[model samples]
Target: MNTNTNTNAIAAARQAHSTRCRQRVLTALEQAAHSGDEITVSAIARRARVDRSFLYRHRDLHAAVLVKAAEPATASTGGPSASRPSLIADLANAHDRITRLSHENTQLRQRLSEHLGEQAWRESGLCPPDDIDRLQRRVTELEQHTAEQRRQLAERDDELDATRATNRELMTRLNRPHPDGA
Candidate 1:
């Protein structure tokens, strides 16, 4: 029996690929419950491309995605109307637009810590202010322009040491032997 007909043709090709992955995860949970959408086991394993651990090992597609994620959202012109906005007035207008954008981000971070002064607001550790009087008047105008460039480089090194002591006394009076011994 050719190995019992090749083990019943590899168990009928793994039961026709587990009946085409359980009919594409029950037609992607009936097209995410006819489009109100959010059903979930990772949105029916990304609309049945499959494996969220095969929709958590299929306990009836994980109890039909927890009974279509506890059902309640009907409205497509089917009933509830008094001019729409209910889910607790859309969660109290999203908590009053997140408390008016968290008090306009604390008044634009207290006007950028009073326009970034105090040594650029303590080197940006945010807010602390003794106001570095304009960085101590730009470090007292760069220490009086570095003490007037060190008094003009000590008067050009005392005029290059008096022109190198008058060129070493005119090369010691032309090498001394000009005493009429021309």
Candidate 2:
């Protein structure tokens, strides 16, 4: 009978300890939520001064933590509430800003690289000579060739016209009656 009484006392003490731990966990959860702090399982466990395994062992407590964690933190401190949509919009804006900055950075880098390359080339004394005079001479030669081709085409046109006129005259004379009939 004495051994059974001792067992009951042990069970009672364990039940009391469990009740205290559960209360502590609930209080910690409320505090964390009110303060707009993160409600992760690890954070709750630490805040409650309870082992992670303890929360896991109590399925109700674990589910409560999960539910609270899924909820967006309410700003009881007069700050902005971090809603899911607002956070996502903020992230998208940040990503767009980063993309724009990256593109600008690439353009600036390319310009700098081009400027440096030109400077280096000039310093190396290997710059190619200007070909303005050569280009001008070539242009003049092509213009003269083009003029000659046009002149030849005009001459051919005049010759063709004259040949057509002569053929018409010959045909007119042949069609006319001869002075003496054959």
Clash totals in order:
0, 0
Local accuracy of candidate 2 as per-residue lDDT tens digits, 62-100: 999988877888886777678555677999999999999
List clashing residue pairs in candidate 1.
Answer: none
Q: By summed lDDT, which 10 consecutive residues of candidate 1 come out lowest?
A: 79-88
Candidate 1 lDDT, tens digit per residue, 54-160? 77776887888888666654546687533223555888899999999999999999888887666675788876445668888889999999999999999999998
Q: Which stretches of candidate 1 lie over 4 Å from their true place?
A: 1-96, 103-135, 169-171, 179-182
Q: Candidate 1, residue 174: CA error in Å?
A: 4.1
Question: If scored against the real structure, what TM-score would every candidate get?
Answer: 0.30, 0.59
Best by lDDT: 2
Q: What is the TM-score (0 to 1) of candidate 2? A: 0.59
